[model samples]
Target: MAGIQFTDSAQTYLADLLSKQNTDGIGIRVFITQPGTPYAETCIAYCKPGEEKEDDQKLQLEQILVWLDGISVPFLDDALVDYATDRMGGQLTIKAPNAKVPMVNEDSPLNERINYLLQTEINPGLASHGGDVKLVDVVEGGIAILQFGGGCQGCGMVDVTLKEGIEKTMIARIPEITGVRDVTDHTVKENAYY
Candidate 1:
């Protein structure tokens, strides 16, 4: 959560959401994934049914603000939580403006390559046990986000697969790929292969 900042718009959105709840208490829950998850999701909730009350709402907001003051705003700064309605259904979408986007390195031709080596090369080897590999993103610092799926979700061999297998193979084949990082949040999912 270092170097995180919240834009003024994000703060405003949060405040408005609190006001609309019409509950006695409200507070936002913020948590970061452990790494290697499909997507990063955040949730905000109003006071529990039995706990609703005017004082509760005030206290909740106060607590959240206090917590925000202590943390790096920019870490959570660019996040936007919006409510939308459509034919599919009404839902909340949490968008992170500063989320890392993959970049193509210009200096090295290898860097510029958008090859799905993992999909073609790595996945086949893992498919036997219903396992899969997902490429999350290529970060600015030459780090890549990877997610494990299927049998590999909570498999004890994840680290081994990541280090000796994935990392070694990727680095050997693509010299520009400096490092691989798993940004999976294991706690959110039950029975992970790793």
Candidate 2:
């Protein structure tokens, strides 16, 4: 999924709005319209036993339009929704991966250097923990989506290791890497050793 990148501030705003409107068991569903549509809409409806109430459906649609007034409608088109848990509490993050207007070179010399660092320096260092990192894909704006393997699949320290270790090392070696994201889905792994 390639799209605009949302700042932490924008994500916080959207998450707060969703939390306020979330009731019953329904959470917010943020999705973009099919390509070429001018507006992206957000809908809120609870996941009921079988079906959702008509009133609730209408309310959600109305609320989304109101919500869009505050946020940019076009920018929210291609977004990623994820629940984040921190010391404070759990919150949702609406991410726009394609936010940067000017496209940067994903295959730049800097990226090659970073890839080399991950393949040679970082991967070897993680061998002790049975962890491996793979560069899944690089976005045009210098964001690298990585996948974790081996023990890192379900390791509690994966986040810390990624931030304090992997990310830190990558940033130190190459300054152009704006962000490193883990695209691993831990629940579906069938070959995890630890």
Candidate 3:
């Protein structure tokens, strides 16, 4: 899917904003906190030179540079960025379809449905602290296995995140997903954000 779609007005506004900043090789970075769920919110920031991380992805279009942090890619899939003006003033709007509940057909595969819930509904809550979760496998007996990574790997609240957040969300979004299991080894504190 296209990473992000920007309206013409949004492009112009961003370019103008960047030009005003005069920070060479710097542009806007788009990100989300609590992505793909009801509480998700998108944020934009001016990125100066050397601010971009090694693994960050850049989108250059129409004299603008849009940076996507690696950890936020999944949550931002098919997002729309726009600026609208009314009698009051200009307002920035972001339309993230996948940031909420993704459309699901009844016949969708169990694994696919669970994945959608994770990417669209569950994982966004974890993304705030640089965490993400992925589907490991779907086992027999309608068990949906998962592996928490990034900030979630060695998090102190992982159990709460899984049982209260992941499992409950999966069951609500996909009835076929009877249960969830986290197979990640959280002992390594290497990349734990908490």
Which predicted model would earn the best lDDT? 3
Tell me the TM-score of model 1.
0.39
**Candidate 3 lDDT, tens digit per residue, 1-194?**
34788899999888888888867887888877775456877788998888887767888888688888776677677789999999998988988776555445678777667777677667778889889998889898878888988998888889998888888877887777778888999997887986
TM-score of 3: 0.54
Collision count of model 2: 12
lDDT of 2 by residue, 65-159 (tens): 22221123344546555556789977656555333221224465765566567755787777787888888887887788899988778766778
State each candidate's clash count: 28, 12, 1
Question: For model 1, how does the per-residue alpha-carbon lDDT over 1-194 read when each residue is reduced to its tens digit?
Answer: 32333444555566677677776445554433321122534434444345433322122332233133222233345555555657995555666533322222345444324234565467778887678777777888667678887777767777788888888888877766877877655444454543
lDDT of 2: 0.56
> Using TM-score as the measure, what is the rank order of every candidate, best first?
3, 2, 1
Off by over 4 Å in 3: 36-38, 100-194
* Lowest lDDT 10-residue stretch of candidate 2: 62-71
Per-prediction RMSD in angstroms? 13.0, 16.5, 10.7
Model 3 residue pairs with clashes? 36-99
